[model samples]
Target: MSNQEENINLPLVHKGKVRNVYDFNGNYLIVASDRISAFDWVIPTLIPNKGKVLHKLSMFWFDFVKDIVPNHIITGNFEEFPAELKKYEYLRDRSMIVKKANRVDIECIIRGYLAGSGWKEYQKSKTVCGIKLPDGLQESSKLPQPIFTPSSKEENGKHDENISFEETVKRTGKDTAEKLQELSISLYKKVADYALTKGIILADTKLEFGFYDGHLILIDEIFTPDSSRFWEVEKYAQGVSQDSLDKQYVRDYLEKIKWDKSSPAPELPKDIVEKTLEKYTDAYEKLTGRKF
Candidate 1:
């Protein structure tokens, strides 16, 4: 992303990994940037048009699932944008005005397959976040059924720690915990089933919930490549890591180079950036059935 955003007139409320959120009167303006992060470090280089790709894909999924759950989006229309963003032509499709809500502090993650932290924990204990699985599960192996794994919401630099289901009930009330877990799994199943028709496997994804108007609402990005592990369906196999179309593409490259994953990450090569864009674009197109 460019430094041009400094000239925009808005009260920046939160600067996340790839999205810069600003307060919009009673709402919020989330601007998706081309910034790519690997190992929790936002890289020095960017994939072209990545911001719009992610933002557009998120918009698509939000509409597709709005019937299943309430979301925070107001509209992506420029006409509905506040006067502050009216003069900023660059904030067109990459930005959205959303109603702000009292955010739930728990990270609601649902896993349909063994990968990432779930895989690591399963490798040692045959369980994921205290949820036991059948024996003989391998890396990239699909779980017998989807499972809810809750985690604590951490600061930008800190890793999110997984907590057991019982512990989640302790943190959030038992009712809220049950609601989150049930909603998360249902949402995951719906999206995962849709992705299968598109020839993409929705391995797992995280959802953030917030209480709005005394009800739970889904917030933040949903099922985008940035927030989910998407593997090409044709290449998926048990006992082997599958080729992916999400940020895992960049993670794999970073792992290969052994960059130590600390702050001030090494610059990405031009080819890497191009490949990353290809994956992100492909995911958007496949999921939404629209040209990226």
Candidate 2:
């Protein structure tokens, strides 16, 4: 269901491209919708079971990394949710009760491999987010080391532009900026390593952090196909774009059709929607070792 169609009784707080946030008492109820977006547009079609895949994968990763950083999740367990929430059986496995936080307005991006906007930046200035890289890096070449590149977090329907670390310090305080970098890189390395063991390469991922109760904690989604680039290890090639277990498949289709970004987004074909859900479920199964 689309965010606009969600029928939760709580006061609507924010409706993102693929999720709806509702004010639940003083906390928040975050529901993952089946809506899929590409090129900053929320596609009109819904992918079946897409929301459950994102929510379940996030629940697994949140538990896996809780030792490194606390998250906004209060409980993913439906049984533990408030009695009022239990009435919405459709929310099962697709929603979470979370702490409301003062979210930091930076997209904490860690790139282990050169691709996407980072590659476009490297082709011209040999830098990403103003971080210089080694000479002669190909389109999808593995970087010598992962780097923390941050961007300004824009509101929904706007594009997020890459920013320099200095700009990050300017926007946030120096101490907060440094801590964000440290935590972002650490989290990326740990999860990337774990993904490698599962035969998937976590090319790059954007993380969101927020201040909750005077402590910085992870917020939003983590390592899910929507938030991260996942490539099959066996299919990876340096000089070309690798097949991804993410929405990149849908993005490629949109690009192939040459959909003018200014126009109303096109509805995805049935095969495309099915394949997209397959990719998301594939990532979830491979990373978490659970059938989807």
Candidate 3:
């Protein structure tokens, strides 16, 4: 519910595309609203409970993936949250109180399947992010294995440009880039495999990492629909676009409507919003094996 607004009462630190980060002394309180964005533009409407779905799902992963790498999450528990924020019951499940990290400026992406821009790139050049792929791979085709594909993290309203492994080294130094590459792929592989048990195909996901107390820790949201493509296992097919439990559905609707992805993005229809909510909630329940 925060754009670029700065109010003295809130001590807002940064407002990204969908998250409002408030500086809570040394720590930070990140609040995700029900804002749904597509084509890099926040649409005209909001989806009820969308933020909670994302927030809770991320909390589940922070704990689930901690053995791979430590994270920035302090707690999403209401009692453990800051005293000032505890008064609002709505924020209890939808807000995360996290430790501040020296934010990394890279998007650590890992792809286990051909989809989205990767599919488009492969169709024309038989490559993705400058990496050559085998011949005859179709859309949504599984990769030989998970590949690390890092991108330059862009500022709000700017598109992130995919960069090569060499470029990642140049931007963040060889040592840090290597860590990001190793950690991203390992986490993706582990989680992608685990997701299969939940009856979901983890096509790929984006992650952000940063230095916390001299240790590289995973930061930002991990494995949420907004960050990952969650395809239903039964609906997956090699040559066809798989049914997704993610924001891809919204993008599909937008594509069908032929809406120019400029400002004044069209408001999503009620059915579209309802379907998205169902997908989000379903993903949460299945992945966590807990009631949403």
Candidate 4:
């Protein structure tokens, strides 16, 4: 459903691909459902506990990275939630009550490797998002240094176009743009290094930020299976796709299908869904050092 249509019943604020956000007076309640998407489209089946898993993962990261950057989470107290959602107490870990703010209109992306859309751009013009890369870089190859790649935060169903840092400055003002880039790179480096010690490689990730009284705070989800590419450190090899604990199974299944990616998405088989769930669980366990 379109975001506006989905907002009609509840005090819905924003509905993204996998989560439904609701506004209750001054506080906001973000609900993570069982929704699963492939190739930017929501598939029919649901992954059990997928919402809770993502919520817990983000909560864990927010705590881990809080020392480096502040977040917008207010509370996840189930007992204090409004009576309207009393039945969903089980989802306490899957949702959060946060102080909503004016979220910036740019997606702060940090890339430490050449892959995905970045790889495609490099193939065409030896650049990704208007930033030129060095010569002789292979697919999935690590760059000499991580770079901050910013993009316009398009609405749901629209594409997010990558733009240069100067363009980002034009849109978000010079100071805000500079601050987002600095914080993005810092958070990515710290988290990536921590993940390395745990045997997982954070290939690249995107972060969403919002402003509360002129202070930039990390909002939305952070470093989950959906937001970041998590690969096995031992399988790290340049010039090829690495085995991942993220959405590799889903992408592989989609590749096997004969359906054109442009058209409506094809349905995934049960085995594919089950395997994807396992990967998500594995990633959570590895990152948090706790069983999902």
Candidate 3 lDDT tens digits, 1-292: 5432232246878877677888887898888778888888888788888988899899889998899999998888777876677666667677888889998899999999999999999999999999999999999999998888888888867888999999999989999999999999999988998999999999999999989999999988899998999988888889988889999999999999999777578989999999999998999998989998
The Cα error of candidate 3 at residue 164, in Å, is: 0.7
Task: Show the lowest summed lDDT stretch of 10 residues, model 3.
Answer: 1-10
Could you tell me which residue pairs clash in candidate 2? none
Tens-place lDDT digits, model 2, residues 182-266: 9999999999999999999999999999999899999998999999999999999999998999999999999999999888799
RMSD of 2: 1.3
What are the per-residue Cα lDDT tens digits for candidate 1 across 1-292?
A: 3766787778899998899999877899989988988777889897778889888998998998888899999998777776768898778888888989889989999999999888888989988999989999899988889999999988958987899989899988999999999999989999999999999999999899999999999998888889899999888898888789988888889889888876579888999899989999999999888997
In model 2, the worst 10-residue window by lDDT is 1-10
lDDT of every model, 2 decimals: 0.89, 0.92, 0.88, 0.84
Whichever of 3 and 4 has more TM-score, that candidate is 3
* TM-score for each predicted model, relative to the true structure: 0.96, 0.97, 0.96, 0.93
Q: After superposition, how far is residue 12 of candidate 2 from its true place, in Å?
A: 0.4
How many angstroms is residue 140 displaced in model 3 relative to the true structure, after the best TM-score fit? 0.5
Q: For candidate 4, lDDT tens digit of each residue in 1-292?
A: 4343343355877878889888776878887877777667777777777887899899899999998778988876676676776665554677788888789999999998887889988989999888878989998898888889998988858777888999999999999999999999999999999999999989899899999977999999999888888988887899987777877567777777765667777667888778888999999998889988
Going through the candidates in the order shown, the clash numbers are: 0, 0, 0, 0
Ranking 2 against 4 by lDDT, winner: 2
Better structure of 1 and 3 per lDDT: 1
Segments in model 3 whose C-alpha atoms lie over 4 Å from true places:
2-8
